[model samples]
Target: MDLFSGTTFKRAVAAAVALPLAGGATLVAAGPAAADEEDYKILVVGKTLGFRHSHIDDTTRALIDLGEDNGFTVDVWDPPNDSAGWWGSGSPGQPDLTMDSTPFTSAEDLSQYATLVFVSPVDNTNSLNPATPRLLDDTELAALQGYVHGGGGFVGLHAATDTMHTVPWYGELTGGGARFASHPQQQTATMRVESPAHPSTAHLPAVWERFDEWYNYTTNPRADVHVLLTLDESTYSPGNNAMGEDHPISWCQNFEGGRSWYEGAGHTDASWTDPLFLEHVLKGVEWTAGVVEGGGNCVTFPEVDAVVAGLNTSAVGDGVIAGAIASLLGSARTAAEAGDPATAVQVLGGARSLVDHLSAAAGDRDLLASKIDDLVDWQTGLVDDGPALDLAAEAELRTMGGKQYLAVRVLNEDDAAVDITVTTPYGSKEFAAVAPTKNAYQAFATRLVEVPAGEVTVTATAVLDGETVTEEVAVAYAGTA
Candidate 1:
């Protein structure tokens, strides 16, 4: 069945085979080949102009690391740097990822491998002459279509998504297209995982904060792609965005006949250093190579509570942008303080648009979203509504004479100074003590006191507003008063 003919054919094609490297680039990668079967054979294709060299190098290194860890051989394809056009003047020591340096000519060359990683762009790129250029034409597309249709794998990093928008079919193959409709400011921001079970993210940290260029895709992928991780908009970014409420930072899909994944989070050298991010990229490689299974399904933000809260780039000044974000944050904070958890949640949820806006405006978004994630935690956990705090000290109680004191501190500084009250057989008394002002602080004074001998009941309340909050710990006294 032709995978491109109909939706059912596409579904059948997706389920029939796993990720396989494709094309003529497989001979150059280096690694220990699996048994006779060679479970994982990968091809890293790096050939483009004006393409950032750091991203290509980092992605190649990351693939090598994945192969080493997972027991697979990687075939790196570095065509003559001269063929890379104006942007091809890369520093030496690169273009040496693998042993193969064959010039990629057709789709048949690409079909041999199980996975194909496009590190650079290939559209109207000219290396030899201006009139004559190396472009992906009908034959190339047919070959690529066949490779993936036969269960091959695909992965694109950084600018790969920036290529081939003029060719509608190529854009569809990439799940995104050339030239983002919006390019937001670059800032450090968090990438929250939406599909934790997939191989590409099994070990990735729940929140990946790094710096990179978040492209505003010309042809969005939300309709047909399975979003894995997204940029939380509570932080700084473009004011008006085309990606809508949930902006995809990383995702995977069964395209043509193969499992594919692409991440928009690899624009910086520093980002390559993050172990978690490296692992994520590695997992995608592994999954595409069929060493791992399970591509994520499409995910949507159902409600406000589902959005992860964190700090991002909204604080950076752009005057208008900053002012607007401040207004939103102030509103969320006020709502939370006014004992309106629902209202605060909604306000904070809406703040995601702020992040999208700032990212598009700034032309860089990775760090920006990360910054927003940080701030969101402070505001969203309005009165402890954020991610849970490990504020409870060791279960062991500290002994003070005959008194037992249980130490508890706010998980975050923003949650500090909350009202706390203790209830006992004598009467209900509220203790006024400011919460620790730092991210983590010790409150040794907050302990459980044994009621004077023979007291029947003891209760403690930790309050954020009008009601008692903390868990109740009962203290039983043995002796008579």
Candidate 2:
């Protein structure tokens, strides 16, 4: 049995409306019959074994609209059984489907479309029958494997992971298996972006707050997968899924020779219609169908604003606070890259106020921290780090390295050795200063540093023959805890 049982809408009002509209009466009978046909071909594999009416109905309508707009043919595969049922009238206004399209029964049937959309159910978790009927049992699995391996695209929406948990290949293909360990019975949480450079998320807001059943998967095989969006725990209750600190809500991965994407936030009817949420799904679908080249990361103005605000509030006013905030911003950037936006936001939010006030004060320390925050945010999103180059800028930061060390590179010039100073929370240490004889642009680079789990500051000052040129840039470092 599939995760959800389908319900028959024997007398649904939508069915009545759809009949007349689909019969060529909507446009007042315009254009040639073939010219009016939709373009893209999509297969919406509805509930066959584990079916849900609401899920199918909502997603089906959305896909239909997308197909019409994007020129795709939508074929819904809905098969009926005694335990689970299909909804659609035999005619235009009826409640039962006019036809039964069971693509899972044969490979030939499944090959009719270019892309296959999985909308929830696979097998029954609670079954009474001796022989279980799975969506990708014998025939459908082979067809799907061939389709994707042959370059066919796959899209999974909302409860896609909720299905096909029993199949190892399916689990590997989707990057995880079903485990409804802890999900919010009601919805209210923020979805943040851990990766901001991916294509689908370029336009998405940093934190997506909505109501829906959030699924916590058994395993998150997303370290290597391209993560588009992540769930922030501070926004909702952490459920049963024992995963990392930051959880993934949407992601795309390359499977075999095919592309696949899964989004786990569409369990409600409202989600299907919300313009923002719907837009996200549309982007994902287009990406999977090979219509789009790359997806932007899920970074939004809100998250960035939040970080900015956080820095202003915490450590931007006082010189000491400024120095601390700069270090914090560095740590936040590291956390963001490590797929922990919550931690990144937390670190930034905690220090925003201080940094803002310090910047107003025009204190060198405060300005330095503010600058660090900007650089960190840019680095996390793969944006430009060099803004207005402040030659008058001055900051003091610490660098701790054993084998791997820091190097500085100026714009349009060769790499130059940088003279840096390290300051522990307790004291300070000075390293041998390697001064450049001539003027060329310079930037900093360093390998991953392993330090004790504590806060440290790194400051760099450019000196030319005992005279200071550029202001110091201070960066905070938080060692592994």
Candidate 3:
């Protein structure tokens, strides 16, 4: 499948159109409706398949206001009370969908927005018999995977980590490296800002306290994701899923070819009224959408000082190595405090040379070295030798001479090359050495199936440098039955 996006086609429809909200409300922004046509737009999906939050509407309204005032507009795909498109209550219930009047179902729909925001959209993870509305089905979610892998932006709030717990990709995309386990009662608690330089936390106090349902993740996301806020367990009773000390509450990451930001707060309607929370969310969306800049890294001086101080200097017989490391970290802290994270990263990089001295002396060299590298990566937003290895697929149903056929296109939309294999129930094709370019598409054609009118999915698996990523696109085949 080719790497085409809806943003390209949205240009023809641009002309300051009116976006529909749930409850028949209308919102108009300053620029075009499509995000990539120039003025940025956000798509918020508030439909819940699990225990629905009462604040979903409030959350949607708040985002609309944010976009209206922040040089952008908002389009919502909120199905009121139990509304689904093809799965249930027709498409009319989903008003002002990001993709015009359609439900937020596939990558084609998601391609129009600069950023996709999930306001506590609980996917069908906690369902028992599927008697109610459900979130994206398999094909829909597969489309979302390819969308994000092709440089899309995503933001998750509240129970988003709990949405698709069974899916490894969604868990990593929203949860960083872990999923939500449980939450305590809604109470006022203190959250310590970790990444003071991040847009979401820049205006927050070092010890910001607020009232909300505190969620505990299955594992600490600190090791894999750039952390912004950590909950202070001492301020509240953390129930069963208590993360003792390093409890990360909010974080952001540069994942695959997309940008992601997730926050565990926003469980209450009151959070929508809170100015701090609003600003935090606005900045997060802006950052994820590439409208603002700030590497979620910005290591605070206190955090760096604490990590260095925690090192066991006992391995060094004398205090020389310890003193030297301390001096370098001190300089880093100074640079960080002076609002020069770039200089701080450089100083930290220079300190890497001193880590070799610790290695020779048999100190905690590995720990220091790894932590230093993590700091630098967070600051520079660089991963895997500074290159993205992403493969994306786009598929369409083409009819030639009264007979229906499915055409596939694959785009190596990143900096590393991959060998792609497209598989379907009817046919499969292999493309070798797909170059790392975003503008080209590799095509293949097949007669989808013997059926008359039904849906089928095409899955593409790309492997490069010992890493494998799979993307899927669904095409519906319909001929005069």
Q: In terms of TM-score, which candidate is strongest? A: 3
Candidate 2 local lDDT, 182-233, one digit each (tens): 5656669788865444445656666778887887776675554566778777
Per candidate, the number of residue pairs that clash is: 63, 64, 3
lDDT of 2 at 443: 23
**lDDT (C-alpha) at residue 327 in model 2:** 69
TM-score of each: 0.51, 0.52, 0.54
The C-alpha stretches of model 3 lying farther than 4 A from their native spots are 1-38, 81-109, 127-134, 295-347, 351-481
Candidate 3 per-residue lDDT over residues 7-85, each given as its tens digit: 1211111122111110111222211125444467778887665566778778888888887888768878766454333
Distance (Å) between predicted and true CA of 127, model 3?
A: 7.0
Best by lDDT: 3
For model 2, give the 10-residue run with minimal summed lDDT. 24-33
| Candidate 2 Cα misplacement greater than 4 A, ranges | 1-38, 51-53, 84-99, 104-112, 126-131, 177-182, 242-244, 296-381, 384-481
lDDT (tens digit, per residue) of candidate 1 on 121-234: 544432224344434555666777777776677888876666555556666666744334555777766678765556666566677766666666655566566667887666
Q: Score each candidate by Cα lDDT.
A: 0.52, 0.53, 0.65
Candidate 2: RMSD over Cα atoms? 24.9
Positional deviation of residue 169's Cα in model 2 after best superposition, in angstroms: 0.5
